[model samples]
Target: MDPLSPVYITGCGAFLPGQPIDNEIMEDHIGRVGGAPSVFGRRALRWNGIARRHYALTPEGRWLHSNASMSAEAVLRALEAAGLGRADLDCLAAATTQGDLLVPGHASAVHGELGGGALELASFQSVCASALMAAKYAWMAVRTGEANCAAACAGEFSSRWFRPEFYEGGALIDTKGRLAMAADFLRFTLSDGAGAVVMESRPRPKGLSLRVQWIDMVSLAGRFDPCMWAGASEQGRAERDGGWSRRGPLAAHAEGAIALQQDFNLLKAVIRAWIGVYLDKVDAGRIDPRAVDHLLCHYSARSLREEIVGLLEATHAMIPEERWFTTLTETGNVGSASIWIMLEALVRSGRVQPGQRILCIVPESGRAMVGFMMLEAVEAVR
Candidate 1:
């Protein structure tokens, strides 16, 4: 195995739970937060421009699929597409914001659910960049000859938190009788799904494979506070004595210490930080925007997309509007799974051609993290 061996994405698969839930029927699945429709939810839906999304819950809001199960299913599909069995894998890496169990890691749970021979496993827990980090690990493993075949997958089960029952006993509305903006904003924007990819040192025998050109990630946490988080009552409290762990389980739950929160005020800073990283990559000659045939960017909302466009144009690094591709409106924001799902959709669409380069950009506002991956479509080796 050559140290400089190129890693190829041999297969891509996605598992979107349940049917496409339209905007009108969203509440029917997630239910109203305070026993009634939320005005904030309605406005957020219109602004986010997500027409439909999937949820791992039924109309009754009961559990339909756990995070681990979804990731396993996606990995199985990816393995099938790669023409490999579970026994062929040397490493399994998974990423997610959270899993059903708190003790075992997400990758371990996915491996147990997948049921295969013992293999090296890695789990990444963060915001959206988790998936890219997992993919980078698999790519490095294959490139370094540490693994002949590796799989990286991401799953997001955010619908459970969006459910009204999750916040039933908590004070969801302010004293003005309005739902909290942070909580309501995400309910309409985030959804559930999982995506997986199989990576190997060589391309597949009879299909298109994306050769991994490079993967770069940057974190700006030192200059920014947490923009999106959970399992904490306040920004810096998660590390202090006032953290969620300090409060008893029941007390924490009752006080809404576990709710997913976002600071909209920091969104502009997130965009700027992401662009700064991109500029650095460009300056280092690692990326040439004009060489990218397709741009797959994971923007949480349409508004954010516009902001990104403005910055790209201002910096003269724009990839052109026509070259950009996204499934956000149709799939919503799947967090760690968004980039994988978008790539899977583009590959499955039959639009990509051999030798075309696809650039992927994923920005995470958990503390302003950004990931960039470049892939080149190549014909399968005979």
Candidate 2:
């Protein structure tokens, strides 16, 4: 198989579970769950720069949907946009930090929701960068002629994992208190959503499509510890885990609830991950800063976005303020779904045109992973 076979993202879609929730509603939820955020938590919320986020749970805290349901819906919309159906799919790859279940894989759940398609299916869990990593694999499958049509998607049911009761259960005491607080800080910033894109070996004529020129991802875990994490740990490990959870400290096993844990060096992590990756790309001649037409980034905080933009401009005269794009403020950090949401917003804004270049940067703090893609928008081939 030729390594250079063309692959195109012919269609994209997203499903935001419910109305966007604001800080006020968030505060009310916390109150109802029996925990008042500490000053640090409240300040962290304000400084996080996310005003609203969509969640799958109701304000009264009801489970409305799972990752599989939202992802299936988004995939259908993407297939519709691509002018194709499930039968056309050669493969389906689903990614998420939060899956509907632990054993069967998110892809299986999605396949069930998609009415049991006869195509290939798989799932990935790599923290926040899972979606793009899945997309990269999907592109490879098509480029290698393993599939003609493929879908890469991610959906996160983050709201269900949040354990407000744990916070209110007097976990905030002594040195462990600040870690718990930081976890709450992250919980407040996370929202639930799903996004999907349909990729094809060939593009349709006279339509919008994005051609992937190149994409690269690097793990900074060994170099840094952002440690923004949730979920279970080795039950018997010496490391006491972090994040929100319903399981008490005395529980025999890890149970329901999302655990939030983070180190305080988030700003440093952002600088190192985002800026460091871009500079490395430039140094390796993989990217020409001046050739980047548009810049899309996943920075949950406004300050991080601004700082990255400033640093990039100072380093290379490439990205301008007008070309920078994100949905963080309105959508909050929808985890792995963020990049696709930003792409959709870019398309809706009508700022992108055929032959224009787009550079998307994604960073995840769960042990620090950074992924960036360089692509060119093109008129579809018939």
Choose the strongest candidate by lDDT: 1
Candidate 1 Cα lDDT to native = 0.88
User: 169 in model 2: Cα distance from truth in Å?
Assistant: 4.3
Per-residue CA lDDT of model 2 for 1-382, tens digit only, reads 6556899888888889877778877756533334444556567666678888887877577777888999999899888888998888879999998688868999889989999548788788977788888898888888888999999999888777565555443433334333345455667777899999998878756578899887788887667544665544323112445323434543412332235555556646556666777787888888776788898878767766666667776676456777788888888888898888788778667888898999988888777788888889988666
TM-score of model number 1: 0.96
Candidate 1 residue 175 C-alpha distance from true site, Å:
4.4
Instruction: Give the per-residue lDDT digits (tens) of candidate 1, residues 311-335.
Output: 7787767789999899998999999
Q: Per-candidate TM vs. native?
A: 0.96, 0.88
**Window of ten residues with lowest summed lDDT in model 2:** 234-243
